[model samples]
Target: MTIGKGLLFSLLISLVVQGCHSVVFKQSFDKQKWNDKEDWDYPQRNNVVDDLVKNHRLKGLNYKQLINLLGIPQGQSEDSAGIYYQIVMDFGNDIDPVYTKNLLIGFNKDSIVNSITINEWKKP
Candidate 1:
């Protein structure tokens, strides 16, 4: 083969190999478990948030109970009448798109959970 032909063939082979490697890596990644709070280094943080959301019981919990169950919030705020706790999760494939979920819990004056809100979105 001519030198130019050989060089072109080699470049094509390299690109194909690299593309295949990326596909394999992405396929092996477990998106469901990525950055899962349950797997975080902090032992206190678990999947309690998932459980609470799944069971629809956040309103039944008090401030202390909620803290004990899910540890501290990523963000917190207080007002004259109530307090808010926010938990945020960002997880998805590392490729083109990603997803995020946020949980906002509101407590009444008595420190009992009064409302729970969840927001989710996708990013590219």
Candidate 2:
């Protein structure tokens, strides 16, 4: 190839490598955020039980309302009466990150939360 063409090809290759590196870096960061045990935000000692007991007012609360108060849930299950949301607040074990399951229970009927419970926040 001509000198000019070779230079252009080289530049293109460099750009491709740089792009790939950036994408890989971004993916690694996202994975770390998702899986890092340290990212779990456990409730403070004084407030832990209190926070769990302050259930969503069944008459006045809904799913979105609960989410607004508590943040996104880790998982959810549903049936005719309502949707049950499992809100994981934090990791129970630093060494075994998967051993803990923080549950923020939300019961929603037709998108409105009829009730909520902090059913379980324990290591399993």
Best by lDDT: 1
TM-score of 1: 0.43
Error of 1 at 12 (Å): 26
**lDDT tens digits, residue span 3-120, model 1:** 9999999999999998986441222212132233454332211234454566546686888887765556666644434343333334454753365455667778788888776656
Give the deviation of candidate 1 from the true structure as CA RMSD.
9.9
> For residues 10-84, could you state the per-residue lDDT of candidate 2 as single tens digits?
999999988986442212112123333433453232233343445324445666775665555556544445444
Q: How many collisions per candidate? A: 0, 1
Show model 1 residue runs off by greater than 4 Å: 1-50, 77-99, 121-124
